[model samples]
Target: MNDVLFRTGGHAARITLNRPRALNSLTHDMVLRIDAKLTEWEHDPAVGTVVITGEGERGLCAGGDIRAIHDDARDGDGRASAAFWRDEYRLNARIAHYPKPYVAVMDGIVMGGGVGVSAHGSVRVVTERSAIAMPETGIGFVPDVGGTHLLARAPGELGTRLALTGARIGAADAILCGLADHYVPSAALGDFVADLAERPVREALARHVRQAPPGVLAGRREWIDSCFAADTVEDIVQRLLDHGGPEAREAAETLLTRSPTAVKVTLAAVRRARGLGALERVLDQEYRVSCACLGSPDLVEGIRAQVVDKDRAPRWSPATLGEVADADVERFFTPLGDRELGLAGDGPLTAPGTAGPGAGR
Candidate 1:
């Protein structure tokens, strides 16, 4: 019920996400419903365009309902969890290639699955209060929902830095990082969206946009690149510690406290995604790794400590990034064997994180 809202106005089809209580966090049912609606609109002649937005003022979508995945795994339902992710990934791909003008009114907190749903659109609008991030590593997961594709395109090691640290970026920083296309004031979203409902083309919407200040991350390029360039998280940590500044030292301590295996594997996944020719391939590789992490102790422990238990401290399987080995990392990427992420139609494989076997453990 609190999933999707569909309405037709003028020549446009509007899809409003309705789960504001949880920041419109996506569930498996929501994912399938969105896919169905998009498919319906794609073939409908009266619908000349589509708009995707969320309810409430707090945010767009936070991400997927990981609580369900956690529950499924606890019940020996890893395959079921993987199936949901596969469908979700397919929906993400559909948004990316939709033929019409797909406009995303990204307001408050947009992240993870939210990024995938809206970032691939023909038009992406951000606002002053917009807080965007891909913080999967912090939760013992890799950035999925085609997030790796966008992260791969980010300037320098900025993607890796964001992925590993779960750092929140403002509208300015988001625009600078290529995550947002246009910036309109947060106060103007309601009026702009209303106006947009009447105007169906790209150019008409551009007139409503007020020029925004350049992104905040523009000046921090040198520092971010230099700090994140290190190959290993430990190396980056050392660099941060050596910098003798509050920012660098604070970042280093933050990384040290995160799941060590998560940081290490996330770095490798980010680097690998950069080399892939397409998003599908990267997602495929991610699926294999994610399946391997099904039995991983860290996935459950991390979720319990952070989401279920609300405890700040997580007891990681490998307590430090330095403790994760190349073999331990390689296991995640190993082929799914017979347990492939197959779907009914044209769908993309999606892994929970960019990790190898034992990642969950």
Candidate 2:
């Protein structure tokens, strides 16, 4: 079956993530197809906007197809996974700079790769059912797909807290964190999309916009800022532990559950991303970190325990924050000599005026 469906209606070109059974996890082919379509629509005068959503009630997208990636990393000499990320990151950059309004109906679980596609859109709409997160730390990977960029820019230390803990937030919190633009009830999403097909994109969205209830994150801002304000993951954990409250204890414990190396690397990535001026630069940095982790023992082991084995007990190398040396973390941020992520216009993955790989067939 087709993993994605695309059609044109009225002034809008619509795309649907069709892998409902898998929570619409993105694949290489799907990413290439979406990028090609977006590139086409970017120049088409008839296409005033683009709208994307998932096919099912479960999720817009859970993440990249990590299980497939795990297999690729094991058998394909990492070439397949590397190519997938390159194309996916390029697609993310395209969506961020698309000439026309890009609308994302982030109605359900939007995590990892899902965030890459939807949260970066110009018009991100979330519903009460939306459970947005960047949970890469739990799987021993730093947040990628420009996730560090979004998380780094979140209010105060909220981004740091979210990055470390892999916490899922509702629509209100998503909006507060700058991950979403508007909130509409899930029931009203269909009507909103219908309106988009007939009216101007902004007008349709404005008509459906409703005030989101205050998110739990807003109330915890003081705690988040105070606990996560430190420069290192170790210091953040110490602060949380020393604060001596249920929230603090829970936050610390959550951090403890993630791969120690991942926590440290994620902290460093987020801090670096704060000073970045462009999304492309942030993506470049993330790609570097991603390639570094691709062959690391922790990434493979973490995936095995949590995904392949389903044991829920990943024995992370450098099992504690103290064991993860500064040099170990720095290597993840270093430039990738020949394999650097090329972010120049059109990039190395797709050429201008030519169909992207997997575009037509």
Candidate 3:
């Protein structure tokens, strides 16, 4: 079956992610097709708006097909996974910059690649059912698809906590973190979608949008800001552990469960992404980091423990965060030689030995 379905009527073109059992996890082909359809719709005078939704009540998307990535990493060369990320990241950039109104209906669980497609859109709609997150650290990978770009810009160090813990947030927190725009109740979603088929996105949103239920992040911001502000992952963990609050110490425990290398690399990527500024530049940086992850033992083991083996206990290489050296983390940022994603549209980043202007470091 087609993993994605497409149709157009009235002023809008719609795309639905169709793999319900797997929660609409994206495959490389799905990424390519979505990009092609967007390119086609961009030029069509009848398509004033573009809407994306998932087929199931479960969620919009879970993430990339990690089972496929696990197989590729364990048995095949890493090139296929890298190629998939290359195209997926490009599609994310297109969605962010797309000229027409791009409306993403984020209901139920959305994570990783789900956040990639929805959070970057011009108009992001969330529901009471929305449980949004990047959650890449849990799978021994850093956030890609402009996630670091969005995370780095969130208020204070809230992004830092979410990145390390791979925590899920509801609609209010998502809006507070700039990951979503308006909130509509889950019951209103059907009418909201029907309205999008005939009216402008703003008008459709106006009809159904309502205040989101309260989120927990705002109350925890004090501790989240203080604990996650440290420069290094170890320091961040230390701060969390030192903080007296039950939630703060709980956050520390959650960090300890993550892949040490992945956590360190994530902290580095998000910090560098903050400096990188532009979404394209940050995405270029993410491509390098993601490709480096394909080479890591943790990426395979994490997926094995979490997804394949269903063990929930990942034996991360190096075993502890203290063992992950600065040099080791830096390797993820190394220029990809001739294979660089170069999405900055200006110039490639300089060698690791030298950090140039707008280097996106």
Candidate 4:
């Protein structure tokens, strides 16, 4: 059976991630197929909106197939991992620029690569079951697939708190973070998506959208902003510890649990992405960081412990935050020359006649 299934009906085109047992984890082939499908749908006037969802109750996607990443990074040269990231990051950029209304049903356990495929879309819908995050730091990897772009743009340092702690936020917090657009109760999703196949996106959303339930981040922003605003990971940790709130202290302890190198590199990546502005540029930078991560000992070991061995104990090489020098973090940002993703739209626009986003809606 296909890992990703595509179909067109009425005013909508659909892409369903079909690996239910794996929480619909994304793969390189899935990425390529989705990209090709998007290209085809973009030219089809019959497709008024494009909708993406997963097949089962678990999630739209858990993440990329990191078991493969572990094997490639551990046993082979890093070229395989690099190619996967190249196509994957390009797909993320395309979603950002897609002229059609791209609707992502971010239903459950959306994390890592899951965020890439869903969050970049123009219309992101989260259900009560949605647990959206970019939890790469926990596995000795930094967030990629335009994750830094989305996180960097989040209000204040809320993004910093989420990135460093690898925290999962619900529908309310996801919308608060600008990671999602609307909230639809999980029970109503079937009808909501069914409506998409028959009506314009605006009409379908009007039928089912509701305000998100309350979330924690709005209340914790005072502490989160003050603590995460520090220049370095070391200072951020210290601020969280010094704040004296249980949540702040817990966030500090959470930082201590993640891979030191990964957290440090993540902090730098998010900050740099903030200044980088365009999503395409941030994605280009992310491609560099992701390829650099493939070379890190932590990437393989972290994957082995967290996913392979199921030990949940990663022995980060730098061990402590201080051991990761300024130079070490800087290496992640270094360019790959000809290998650069070049996703910055140097060429002509994809749809000159298209106004994009709200056009067909």
Candidate 5:
């Protein structure tokens, strides 16, 4: 079977990830297939909505196939890697702006690229087994896949914390943090998909659910707001060091272990993209940052230590947090000219403030 499957049933177009072994890790081809299907369905009169799910119980998607990315980077032809990101980012923009209802079964692992596909959907269902995270920091990359946009909208420094630490949150936390909408048991996904296949009854199914998922960081808002209120990464770290609790302290430690240059540039990028730019524009900015990641010192070294060598210690450029220069960090936002990803001036897929549930929150 194809790694990614696209079909039409009833009023909804069904897209399924067929990879179970790798937890449905999305490769570049899978992304292309998904985009092609979405394009085809856009104009198809028979299809009314779209539902995305995975083949196995392990995850909707673990993330992109980073191993392939690492190898492409190793070969010095970062062009292919860049193309993958460009197309993937475009797909994310399409989904975010898609006109019809987009439903996602966010059971099991949903992280990194998976968030781009599922989080922005009109109906995002999480289960007890849901494990959501933006773990790009662990691999020496900023959280792309439109995660920066979501992070930008998160309350206060909570966005910064998730972007930097690569921490995982359960179903309850995913809802509280605005990453997911509804909560349902994983076992119910089959019936849910079956229902979607028969007709457009999402409103009715939503009302039939039992107790909702718990909130992951409910009471920590005050602390998250206070600690992340700093102007810069260093300032935030200092704030955490001064008065944060165990959660804040541990998050601080995670940041310290990441590439200093990457952490700084990522934080700055997230903050800048918050209000001034829309989702696609911010994704374009992320494209520039990702392209530069190949030429930069942090990405390769990070992959070597974390993925290849398995040493768990990356020697970041400038070596320490204090050495990252403001100018150096600014280069990430610089335009790539012809290499840039462009979008038309027409309206987005969804209305400005109506993308999915709790959009722009």
Candidate 6:
């Protein structure tokens, strides 16, 4: 079957991620196809809105196909991985700025690449089954796909906590953290999409939205803000350790398990993303970091343990935050010289007028 299914009917354009058995993990070809379709439908007068979702009962998308990246890294060739990231990041930028309303039905697992596809849309929908996260740190890489842009904009230091821990959040928490916009039950999603095909997007969505449950992050915002507001990962860990609460201790332990380099880099990325003026700028920074990590051992090792071997025990280089030098962390943020991602455009996929969503957060 096609990895992705795209169709246009009535007043809506629809795209479904079709790889259900793999949780609809995005492939490089899939990203390019999505960009093409969005570009084609952007100015179609009959298409008032675009709707994206995944096939099957499992979820929307788990993430990018990490095994592909792992294999490329193992081969000591970074071309494929690098090309995938460059294109994926550009697709993300396109979605952020698309002039017509873009709707993402985040019905299930929305993490990593999935977040890139959904979270930036103008209308982001979630269901009771939604489990949203940017769990890249756990895989020995900082969150990309403009993850830092959304996480950085989250209320308080919740973004920092989420970035470092790679923790999963429910639908309400997804809304609270600004990663999602509406909460519609799983049962109502079909009817909502049907209405979207025949009626105005805002009206269709408004009619289906329901009250989300109390968010877990909302109640802990004060503590999350205090503990994660530190300047470095080391400082944040110390604060979490000293806080002497179960949540704080758990957060600290989770950080300990992730790549020390990734933890430090993620802290810096989220902090810097907060000051960025545009999503493209944030994506540019992420591309630099991603390319740097492609040459590092930790990323491959992390994927081996978590996905390949299922060991869940990765031996990260520079094993502790203290062992990671400031210069080592700085290397990930440096310019890519000739290989930088270039996303300038005046096409249908490009955002109209100002910088698209998540700009100036």
Best by TM-score: 4
Model 6 pairs whose backbones collide: 97-351
Models 1 onward score TM values of 0.91, 0.94, 0.95, 0.98, 0.92, 0.96
> What is the per-residue lDDT of model 4 for residues 1-361, given as tens digits with 9 covering 90 to 100?
9999999988899999999999999899999999999999988989988999999988999999999999999899888888999999888878877888999999988999999998988899999999998999999999998998889999999998899889999999999999999999999999999999998788999999998899999999999999999999999999999999999999999999999999999999999999999888998899999999989999999889989999998888989999999999999999899989898856633657755433432
Cα lDDT tens digits, model 6, 99-186, are: 7788899998888999999998888999999999999888899999999999998889988899999999999999888999889999
Error of 2 at 9 (Å): 1.0
In order, the Cα lDDT scores of the candidates are 0.76, 0.88, 0.89, 0.91, 0.81, 0.89
In model 6, where is the ten-residue run with the lowest total lDDT? 343-352
lDDT of 4 at 155: 98
Screening candidate 5 with a backbone cut-off below 3 angstroms (N, C-alpha, C), the clashing residue pairs are: 97-349, 97-350, 172-214, 173-216
Off by over 4 Å in 3: 346-361
Clashing pairs in 3: none
User: Regarding lDDT, does 1 or 2 come out ahead?
Assistant: 2
Error of 3 at 57 (Å): 0.8
Native-to-model Cα distance after best TM-score fit, residue 153 in candidate 4, in Å = 0.6
Q: Give the better candidate number (1 or 3) by TM-score.
A: 3
Off by over 4 Å in 1: 342-361
Candidate with top lDDT is 4
TM-score: the better of candidates 2 and 5: 2
Number of clashing pairs per prediction, in order: 11, 0, 0, 0, 4, 1
User: What lDDT does candidate 5 reach at residue 185?
Assistant: 80
Which residue runs of candidate 6 sit more than 4 Å off their true CA positions?
A: 344-361
Q: In candidate 5, residue 143 scores what lDDT?
A: 84
Stronger candidate by lDDT (3 vs 5): 3
